[model samples]
Target: MGGFRSRSESGRTGSGDKGHDKGQDNRKRQGGNRGGGRGGNKGYERRSESHRREHDNARRRIGSGDRVRDIVFEVLRKVSTDAAFANIALPAALREQKIHGRDAAFATELTYGTLRMQGLLDAVIAEAAGRPVDKIDAVVLDALRLGAYQILRTRVDDHAAVDTTVELVKANGEAKASGFTNGVLRTLTRTPAETWESRVTAKVTDPVARLALQTSHPTWIAEAFNAALGGTPDAPATELADALAADDARPVVHLAARPGQMSGEELALVTGGDEGRWSPYAVYLPEGDPGDLDPVRDGLAGVQDEGSQLIALAMLRAEVADDHGRWLDLCSGPGGKTAFLASWAMGDRATVDAVEPAAHRAKLVRTATSGLPARVHEGDGRRLAEIRGLDMPVSPEGDGFDRVLVDAPCTGLGALRRRPEARWRKTPADVAELVPLQKDLLRSALKATRPGGIVVYSTCSPHPAETRDVVRAVADQTGAVIEDATALFPDLVESGTLDSAPFVQLWPHRHGTDAMFFAMLRVTA
Candidate 1:
């Protein structure tokens, strides 16, 4: 399974703190004060105490200069010792330590930033340490990598980075190793490796290796994105590095109106983005508490990406007949797309079926589409066709579905700005492993569709293996033809030029949206 565990098995459930027993004891003590004379004051005092403890824990877990160093070390330790993923382990650690607010934000920055820049960071570390980075203890290597990131990229004080890392070493029950941590960090910070520049400037080299080391992407991914976009290999590598380096805190929230429930104008007043974009009904929200929006709070609006909305709209535009038919979201999870599809279908009197394999995510899809009239399935998309044959919710009576969306599970390289740490954690092997799974999902979605139905294969990543190659392979195998995605969604097409392939690709630097790729394939029955 490419080291990918199910969410529950991964410990992603929202447990608060893991290391401290004092918090639990305090809570129990507070419960005993429920019938006491000073109940209100005691309650306030307990809450204050809890907040202080949380803040202190945050500081200890990820201090200012040591934030990225500590987190990356922890992630690496968990990954090496427990065979954990950076994505699953890092988030769990942050939440468990009650690291929120600025401290939490800093921890996120350090962890993700170090991961994204690991290729470069490791190169620097290797040169400075005068030894291969892989030979080092995973914990010590991660700690050094974290320290390298702060010294090279961040404005954190050098002394603080060194001292705090030493503290992290000691706090981690490695008091004897604190001197080693301090020695390494100080040596590297004092004399950063000069080999990185020479490596970047060299030309006669392995393309993937060059890209991976210099651009901080797995070599295969650089090749895949380059091949998919028909661009020079160097361009995608540079772009990937830039995307990874982009600040994570600036993510924009998108708000959409519930179909026939709220107007765009109403949503605009709440979200406050430019309301005159391609999807007039959609608005981009600047950074704010989305829960503060009344419509969102009341379930009349949802927080989704504009790129995702465009994906749904592109599929809808493929074939909008007077007769409303069925729609399916093959991999609807955490249900953003499912909610949008359900709302649109409900307003148009069209039936929409959303399928998700995971129970928790499927429940989220159900909750997101609760007020809308849509069927939610807790089954895998790869098995949907066979499941339908065995009296599943999918009926054989009408057109299987007029529009089917296969938002396949991907490496998510395109959505790097949103999932800051993902770029760091993902490897070439990860993308390679996801190709077969994505191919199967797309194939299943095609088989479940009606003759004239459109199967839209979408990915948050611009990687060719996961996006273009997968779609092309499926099309060739099934004899499904590719149509012009821009022609279908003209509003989404760039205004200037139209001389190329059929799929639609949105880029962050170019489209001002998350880099998303979409291809509309018409299955010939």
Candidate 2:
């Protein structure tokens, strides 16, 4: 494992500026006041040691082994053990635990940070424990990750981080591992965050491994990001570190100003956000919960990444020689793009047929597109030929849909920043397993499109196998013409990148959007 050594293995935990003794000296010099950090900040990792100590001391005075950490650990447990999503699980947990204001913000950072840095956390933990992270008990591991995140990346004091984690593990019946947990964290505290970055990556000579260890991403993911940036796994990626770093940072929340209902400017004024760079219907929420906004609650606006809005907007902008009123959103679920599509379709005198195999998500699509000219069909888009209840529109010659969006279910590599725990959960096997399904959906989508109609193939992933390969396979098989999808996007899209590719790929590092890939195909007439 690429991480600093533990006391048990190396007989020393190493040292640096924020090491235990120096950090304690700083806290003492500040007289241990407990007012500087009541809540967390966007830059919690970089806060001064004394400032973090005051934050920890304030928590200690109010509630040690408290609700904030309890909530964070619970969310981590759910994510690691139950595969629950942090974004959804965290809000419910915060509400249930009655953690709000600064504490809620604190919990959010700790939870997302712990999950985001899991790979590095595990490596550090394995070194600190002198064993593979896989050997640690699940509950113990969760507690350790929470504590390690605070110790390595937050303003929480080293002592507070260690003690609270020990208390948490004991409270959760990991008493036997509490000592083990304590020793590991204590060993971790001996080094500062900056030093830890170097120590962990020192042994790894491979550029991908070094970036992976430093940025807390899986090696495969770092390699994928590098490859997407036009680098080979063996070569040093000029932008690989930046690409991976983008996932490590907190994501800016974006909202879609429902087409025909409200404009981006109107939504920005209501929510105190800014208009997005690309999609005219996109608004960027800098801070605060979007659910609290009236527009979001009123269905006038919904949280959607700008990349997603671009997918819908790009599909609408793609040229279809003869206009038709029928459109389809294959695999539409938790329907952000579907709503945007249907809203535009409502005014264009068109109808939309959205297919979702999952029942719960189908309901979400129905809810999202309730007032629009859209119909939600609960079935597999991969079997469009046999589906009996599809309410799709046809042309005068019984032709299929004019526009189709195969926002194909993918490995979700592009949106790792939004979904914190997703990176750790996905494996190469998952990608291999999903590729066939991606091809199936694309093939079915191409087959369902009428001659001269356009089909937009997209994924929230930049993986070659998922993005280019899937589109290439389907187009090659069907003789579908791969149109220059870059032209479909507005000129405001990131410059010096993707302007020449036949498709459009938006990166978070470049475009401040999810790594969404778009390819437009015109069916042979």
Candidate 3:
């Protein structure tokens, strides 16, 4: 019967089956049925779905300039009208807009750059714009600022800059005003404004005023740094200009391994570098996705700066011995240093209590120390001495903590590279305003520490009023002995006069790190 079967029947039973099997094999090769089991099909479907979503997201971001501009405009409007801090509002805007990658980078540059050069851009706009810049509608003013930044500073082509900015105005229901924006930007392109120096020299008579205007810094701040550097004839201009023009680049992300939780070698695998020479627990990484590293993702290590790690290590070394005792971080908020202190105190019988005045900022302290063991208190540091006196269990041996860190809040002059807007916003009055608070905080931190215990006062600023002056006044008022931080970190310290009163001042112009100030004081019996 098989031999007598028709050709169609033979084909269906043999060739037809082979053809069907080949088709299935090809489908499997194309990732259609490679996951053949029930579980495999579900997994394959999920991965394929994720890829399609990612593709769609990329497509959405491609022509997202208008949306980005609108969001940025809203942020700028809020900052101007509501007196919002641009740093705080910009992040929220970016998150709300769901902007990422190149779009995020562009928005960041546009917003920050426009704000940073607002004074100059406004002056130019005032000249080019027919209406007074301030008198123009807020939205229109922002449009002009954005357009001015592109035309004057960025490499964006003149026509695109004008057209995009005009489109932004038109989209906001100012279709009639597009011609106005167009004409102003066209005139601006034809005659770009002179450099900041020319404008400063033309406007200001005093050299300090000229420097401040040119650099976009407050004149008083320029004067303060000048005085702090011993008032050299040219020091004011040099230091002020350097501070303002210093690397506006984003800071490097640093990582430190938690004791027992991770080793420096382990962090090295994450940061792609060996442990820092000055700080064995510190790992330096060039900017990248920190979440990609297993140790970071697992919370075995944290992102911290080498300088901050060094500061914490310096405090640890300042203790007469590595014996376990209570440690306090006064004014610990957005707690980067407090986290390091917790890691350093991990194995020892040492315990750390980080105090932050603001509830929200205190939450940051808790979050930073989440993986580590540390006690976070949300209260005024000024009252901490009394509170701890009541709550802390007194050892039969003596008083409270073995060491204290009063990282006082100040004008963040040293961290301008990290906070680009800060250089322009800070004034000498801001420095003056912080001195009393710093003094109070220092006195409280000193009172909280046991006799013979160390208190390290630190600020991410180079201002004398916030640094040497505060330390000097405190040392004169109390029986605290000044210790030389440079003597402790010889490799990191710059050669300077010890008569400068035994403090460490790291300058960005000199040292590679943020301009940090440190003073180690010890209370004597």
Candidate 4:
């Protein structure tokens, strides 16, 4: 990451001030192309401009010879050293490098694919290197990983994957390690991917460990899914394996149409995507970037997972005894759910008070709900029961919100497809660290909600400790009654596979959505 600074298109060319001045002088000597209209200068101008433009283009193309590899390597190195998120860092790097179309798509696939299969790749790398990967230089290891991914997963010519990887190593000033990289990747291409996978997973005696290597998930996370899904005696082993496989596959981009901003059909029609099956507001983009759409640019729609949209919609779908129309999003930073709730509340002449501790995220909430009936409060949501005044008037009763949503933060294991490096980044200890904050946020949300009102507790993880354990612990302390939350999504719960009663866990494999857990509670006096 130290060597890798994002280079702009201009910087890639290795252009100098002298070159710029010379091009300017050439332009002046040749006269203008369109305006001058001088007989001889016209031909001269066209030649001058064409030559100058080609020279500029050549400069831009200098360091960009093997662009796809360079982009992938840069992203991989950053993820390794800076601990940067690939989803966020890759796009910015691609834009800075001016990569688009098929090239951008290739770069994206290579980067995400490489990161996702790093564990499996490393196993094979160690076999090929005949030494532990830990002993290998980090830069060289990155090159080997990228090369291994191409040879194993992609259809790139085996020779090109190895040759370009060696070239990439040399480009990074690791000339001595190029021979080592070549040896490893060439050996990688010699074996079929299936053979390599079998060889890597052969010695894993633990079922969970074997599955983890096969699916490229950490052993603990795979175990967590098994426990969460197999809480009942009837759960099958294949269900957990399928869920892990789904996490490794490419995820379709889901777009949410803001209420009164756009319709799902309209979003699909505009973006050439299809309507999502689960949520009314969801539009599924099969592939490509969502930011390119007009509705997204205009704030009429946004990139949100369908499962997330379902949880937000459940707040409106919940049959509250008294609909106070005041909603509270206790942890409303980076407000995807808050925006959904706010959009629906505006139609009902209600308002939403979104509380976030971070000021920047509060600003993001404001921007997401810009012209909607949402008021963003920059304060700790744990004290949401106390904050009375927001942008709108206060309720006569204290914090009397009819519906409250606590989308408490967790390890984000459910979004592994979108966040390829998450599996390696998260640990079992992280789950322990998150539970207290998650419980506090849920408790505060319950406190701020009105009696007989609905409180939706959710997380983007399926860990039993975070989902059921936290809910049951809080219920025991607060004496809140768990509602039939599954009834809220009747269509999805038809098979009863997704219905865990009082709670709903949507799986990537089962529901084609993230493993989002939702539990609805009714506050009692």
Candidate 5:
């Protein structure tokens, strides 16, 4: 949902050229001897000439002056130096660079692959630099890391990686360090990346820590994932390892066909995507940018995660017999969910009031829900009562909507693959700060819902503190009953039943969607 699909599948799977090892291929080719005859000598000479020509062709393909690497450097600088998000910064750069076909694909691969493996790359860089990576100039380090990424992760010829990287460094006025950069990269490429993985992770005996290095995740996040996946006694080492690998894998783009606008089947046909198996209105994005698609640009459908579409649809599908037909989106920003909910409500002759604190995000919500019966209020959701003033009327039973969605903000660990640099930006302290606010938002959403109404609390995170713990706290304080939400999507659930009581958490490894957590709290009097 609003995710990327790269042309070259480098680093998309955690296996990064592992199955197609160039070294192993060369060994296989050189292992046997040719029969010793003059004719055989001639045959050997012909084969060697052909190999030389092939090598030269590969070198020519890696030639310079493409300007694609420049686009990549600019994005890396914005993300690393300016603390920008890859998802937001990349598109703008691609447009500004005017790169389309194979060049765009190469830029996408280098930028994302380098960022995804930044931690492991840094570890390798530090070992190769003979000092901490921090000791190098920031600009020089970024150039080196980009080079090292191609050498280690991608199938780019090693000579091309080092040569192009040195050229980039020189272009950026780091010519003095070009020799140092070239030496380090050559040393790195001398052995396979898997060998370096073994060397760097050899001393780390803890399963979580070792997995963190192997999977290119922060150690804390690795531990959090392990704990969330039923740690130690219940789940095994392989479970946590698979989850980590999934977090680093590339996520497919998902589109939500807004109700009353377009059908999922029609949208799939127009965009060449397949209809999603989970949500009725969901479509899996085909390759290339969704922005270029007519249906998306026309707002007939918008990019949204299937897991997110499922949760929003679940709130709608909940068995609410009140017939009160009113909806609210508390903390709706960048309004993907609000747009879907509002379109559905429009079909039912209902209305939706979306609350977004930030002005820019509120404007985005307005843009997303344009031409629908949705109102955007720019104010903090914690002040829900004050913000939803007398301008909007409430239900006759009480001062609240019949159905409310609280997509609270929290550590977005569930979407690490989509947001390549987010894993480095988040910390345990961020989770601590967010847990209280998440609970407060849920409480306010519950307070604003009428008795017998349904309030759905959701987050794009699998951390227990931000999900089940928050739901448990609010339910305990308010006496709200948890509905069996997994029943809403029988196809996505494991047992085709709602056995995991109280809340539903979707896993990327198992569900091919962001690890979205959902809880349906019925305001029972």
Candidate 6:
């Protein structure tokens, strides 16, 4: 997302985060405009009148043309009106607005933070406005979300946050709604975020709903994460809150140093990053534009989640009998895993065939594996077995790939950290809609694998409907043997199992990785 903060600000503890509001900080925030700034109480009546006039005067400063806030508002507007992803939209907005340094950091925080905490922000906005957020105009609501986020969360002075946002609304052609925006934000400034949390969730009685409010997640997402952690609907797992909070936290970038080209330690030293805890090839980027680094630009290494690296690592480690040096990435796109696989496969003189139906993503796969012995095929993965003329080996002993990967597409629930606003964009219906394709892809992968071959089915989601359930049905239907995939990473998955099933679900809280689900299947028939 290109978000950065001063090392000092980044290193500070959570006391400075949302809802803490220390006494010193509050006094600093007020700018001597509220609470006991007067020489005398003046019997409370006069004090209240005096405070209101001064507050209005402060709000009148407008503070317009704040390029940082303007960048954030533009990103939010794109995300709201055009459904643009914040990470993609933010960097472009920053460059187009020519914002950099702390100003860029402020814009990044406001963009990501507001979107990440959108659930809670909208709840507070609703109560303050005495109406549902949907009742407000979309463009106007974007301005309000920005203002409320700054006032309630960041250390931006209350009046500056309000005044700048009122101008932002006017600049966005919502001059009429500027009054409504100002009134709503002024109402919000009266209470601290701690009190507002209680006010927003006062009537929400469900345990899942309460967790959602507390953690700024949609209730269903919290419930889904809870279920993936072994809780039932409306109930929470023991670690549910911790899991959601970890997912809600800002994620550090992980880069995979392409095998045979660079080692993790060498990359870490050169890039000023740290070697990752689990994956041998993983490097944790402390903070910087990875594109500015040589390794990334030269394709010696690429940005990928350590959890994602594990998916390819497990495939490499899985035992395949009479290996034929042929591998298939059944749904490779944006090619992170495919590149990782091809880099490792180079040592064995192996070839990789990648299938991606989208033309644009197919180009990404091609570019990501440019110098590698990988083939890119733009077609549905479900037709892999039927595409007979595609030059794959058919050894009569059992003609199919020795190893197959079905990184099936799903709702991407596990990757909420990278895309802050996605939780609000997803729905239970999305999981339901994707389940059939997930099963179909897994079934195709199993069919495309020869006897004694291994097929790894994975998703960047822990939702049961997309992970264990899909693997279970395909394995049962195909009579494939289920291997305890947790054994592949015994040190990483200390629990040895997920809900006692022979599958691995790496979580953000437990592994500090995306909630990736892995199931390794062996074809015995």
| Global Cα lDDT for candidate 3 | 0.70
lDDT (tens digit, per residue) of candidate 3 on 262-310: 7777788756865665567777677576768888777678777666666
Task: Indicate which candidate wins on lDDT.
Answer: 6
| Better structure of 1 and 3 per TM-score | 3
Off by over 4 Å in 2: 1-64, 391-398
lDDT of each: 0.67, 0.82, 0.70, 0.80, 0.80, 0.82
lDDT tens per residue, model 4, 265-301: 9888999999988898899999776888888888889
TM-score of each: 0.75, 0.85, 0.77, 0.84, 0.84, 0.86
Candidate 4: 10-residue stretch with minimal lDDT? 1-10
- Please identify which of the two predictions, 5 or 6, would achieve the higher lDDT against the true structure: 6
RMSD of each: 13.6, 11.1, 20.7, 13.4, 12.3, 10.2
Per-residue C-alpha lDDT of model 1 across residues 388-506, encoded as one tens digit per residue: 42222344434557788999888788776665456556788887799999999888888877666788999988877777789889999988888888886565555632223587777
Winning candidate number (TM-score): 6
Q: Which ten residues in a row have the lowest lDDT in candidate 5?
A: 1-10
lDDT of 1: 0.67
Superposition error at 414 for model 3 (Å): 2.7
List model 2 lDDT by residue over 22-119, tens digit each: 54576565643544563543244346655656655564445435778877887888887788999999999888877789998898888888888888
Please estimate how well model 4 matches the true structure, expressed as its whole-model Cα lDDT: 0.80
214-278 per-residue lDDT for model 6 (tens digits): 78888888888887888876557888888888866888889999988999999999999999988
TM-score of model 2 relative to the true fold?
0.85
Looking at model 6, which ten-residue stretch has the lowest summed lDDT? 1-10
Estimate, for each residue in 263-335, the C-alpha lDDT of model 5 and write its tens digit: 9999999999999877888898867779999989999999999999988898898877664777889988999
